[model samples]
Target chain A: MRRALKVIVLGVWLLITLFPLYWIIVTSLKPKAEIFTLPIKYWPGNVTFEHYADLFSFADFGAYLLNSLLVSLVAAAGVTVIGVLGGYTLARFSFPGRGALMLAFLVTQMLPLFIALGPLYLLMSDLDLLNRLAGLMLVYVAMLVPFSTIIMRGFYERVPVALEEAAQVDGASRIVAMVRVVIPVMLPGIAATFIFAFVQCWNELFLAITFIDSEDAKTIPVAMNSFITQYDIDWGSMAAATVVSVLPTLVLFAAIRRYIVEGLTAGAVKG
Target chain B: MRPAFTLRKARFIALCLLPGVVFVVLFTYYPMIRGMVIAFQRYNLFDITSTPFVGLENFRAVLAEDRFWTALRNTGTWVAVSLFFQFFLGFGLALLLRRHFRGRGLYQAWVFFPWAMSGFLIGLLWRWMFNGQFGVINDLLLRTGIIDQRIGFLATPGWAMTSVIVANVWYGVTFFAIMIMAALQSVPKELYEAADVDGASKLRQFWHVTLPHIRPTLALIVLLRIIWILNFPDLIYSMTGGGPAGSTDIITTFLIQQVIGGDYGRGGAVGLLILGLLLAFSVFYMNATRFEKAR
Candidate 1:
């Protein structure tokens, strides 16, 4: 009887959760007439790629996808480099400003990014970086790096001091020890941090929309929003836009799912 | 502090930590320091430096505005409502997932799907779904005999704020679920087994054992979630753009339109207000939690 209640409750939650997802998929496949029907249709009446086609022809959907891909990948790679190295240092070494710096990172990590939004915009404007992909990258890096570093710090903290000392005990250079010994154990953690950074950059909205206005640099979400701003939205097309926007997020989440799982575990439980 | 022997080790570590430190200092710390300074001046859009320092002018202006109170009320309401649903639903779902169930993996992946969906995209999706004339929600309700007429979910005052909260809850639930699930999983299986052997039912076990075990994690997750959601401008920005009557306007959204829309001084004041609330809440929560434990 106890087990039965668990099963029932679990089943109902699944229905509530997946129903919107199913709706998204169905709306993507449905014709316009069936999308906003008299009764809300659970199943698509007739499947069509017409909306997807419309998105491609009218908007820069491909460019947005490419931009999102490039940014997510590059930003993840950059953050991992900083996170792993900085995190390793914070974990292993006893330095003067170490505690203060860690506290600083924590402060930056949790503050609302919008608090800096106004001033950062003005600064970016001064530097002639507004509407540039590079500017967006800078903001993303600033926002995401602290998190990645924090994540890396946790992973590094879990490693013992003896290992690195032993590596140096064998007359290995500091850099060499990092590359050869320390990193091998920390690779899974590093990979997890990378996945976390990658997904965040991919899905970031507020600053991206604020900063990147030009078609040349638009990410997937902004371009997707263009479809939504229309008076008579082609529901099928908007659905396609959602599909396109979600593709990289899905792929990154799937490919790095194991690492992603680990990162989230760290962030929630141990963090 | 063995200086001579570990000097090189110290320098190497400092070098490693420097690059990241410089960035945080420049971007996060610098902006905060600058925001405090900006709060003093009547920071005009067309000429920033040219604008004279009007001591406490911005603060006074912000306080005097009726909209500031509305924003405070809206933001406070948003945070409370969002946190309430997010924690409860998330914890509930995590509890459900703890059971031995078929397709749990698939269920989790699907459940986590919204978290991956862009905040901007979710905003747009909800906006479309809630559209009055052709929206799926209104159509569904009328067809189901729930309401006689199409309700303007976004346009009306009472409904607008509630609508934004509902959409926020939808996106927020995934976040809390993932956090709570990780915490729940880390509870040693042996503990549960021992509890079962001792004849403690699930409810008792959850209250006595599980709650205390995961308390710290629960606190941290809630703290982090509140900070993040409170500052988030994009989700609200894209959803209703602070809505039909400014009823749904929050601190972040208010700051954005005011500051980013070129009301630098007033917006900066609003930003400071938000910063104060977050700081106050965090300190208060930590104190209360610690005080409760001490008692």
Candidate 2:
């Protein structure tokens, strides 16, 4: 009886958790007429891809998708590179003010980015970066670098220092030892940090909406937000766009799920 | 033995750290400081020709508004109610998911998938799902003989808050489940075996063994989630736009409105207030965590 109850409980929670996702996918595939029937169709009666076609044809969704992809990619790569250097320095080297620097990174993680939104807008406007993809990338890199650095630092600490010493003993210079020896071992960590940063940048909406006003520069979230704000929200197309927008993050997340769980645990609880 | 610190080493260290430091200072700190400065000025986005310092005027204006207080009150409800449900339900979930089972990995992945999603998109999904006329929720309720009529979940003020909180609870439970599960795993099997040897019942073992083990993590995560939930306006923004007379408007959403309305001064004021609130909580949280560590 207890075992049966436990299974039922888990099953119910699972349904609650996944129903929205299932509903959206099903709703996206449903024909326009079938979407708003008297009794809501549990499943789509007639599947159609017209909404997906409409997403690209009628709306600026193609541009939004490209912009989201480009910005998230560049920013993720930029933050990961910066995170590698910073994380390595913090991990391997001890210098004056290093403690303060680490503390600063931690404090930045605690801060709400919304507190900086207004001035960030003004600063971007002054730099003529408003409505620009590069500008958005810069903001994302800055926003993401702190957590990425911490995650990388955790990864570095796990690898014994003796490896680097062994490399140096083998006539390898410090830089060469790091590049050839340490980095190879940290590839999984690097990929995890990169994907984590990528997902964050892709999912970002507030800064994207605030900074990117032009249709050409708008990201996926901003485009989807605009879609909903229209007088007559095209539920079919919105659902379709949402599915497309979510796919990259879902795929990337599935790839790095284990690393993310570990990273988050370390970064949040221990850090 | 490691080499002594040298000029070349210092140079290399500086080289390694400079890019990140510069980026952070240029983007995060610079804007944050500028935002604080803007709070004291007459910085309207419409007319930026002259933004002279006006000490505490923006703060004063924001404080005087009835909407700000309403948002503040709503923020309390939003965070508390959401956190309450999220913690308990998530704790239950973590307990249930602790055991090894067939397809556990896939089940975990499927359940935690919502956490990977964008807040805005989640809001949009929930908004449509809660729609009055054609919403699945209402349809399900009606078909199941729960409600006789279609009810606008987002249209009514009380229901609007409930609706948003429900979405938040759904989205956030996974996080607590994941964190708590991680914390649970860290408790050694030996400890549980010892408790079992002591003839502790399942409930008592949970109280004596599990509770103490994960309390520190629980406290920290709860604090973090409070700040995050307060900062999270994306869900509420896309869901109701803090609609039906600002019923669901948290302080962050309130700040977003100030920015969207082209009142940078007021927005900055709101931002400072949020910063102050979080900082205060963070100080207390840090001290509490330190106490936990010491114990």
lDDT of each candidate versus the true structure: 0.76, 0.89
lDDT of 1 by residue, A103-183 (tens): 777777566666666677777788788878777777677676677887888887777767877898899987888788889
B190: Cα error in model 1, Å: 5.9
Tens digit of lDDT per residue, candidate 1, span B1-295? Answer: 2235376777788778776777667666777667667777778776765867788889898889888788888988998998899889988888777765678777777777776776677777787778887677787788789999999998898898888888888887877877788788889989989999999998999998898888888887887787777776667777788878788888778887776667677766777777788889999999887776665
TM-score of 1: 0.91
Best by DockQ: 2
- lDDT tens per residue, model 2, B1-295: 5578999999999998898999999999999898888999999989999999999999999999999999999999999999999999998999999999998889998888897887898999999999989999999999889999999999999999999999999998998888899889989999889999999999999888988988887888888788778878989999999988999999999999999888888889999998898888788888988887688
Interface RMSD (C-alpha) of each candidate? 3.3, 2.4
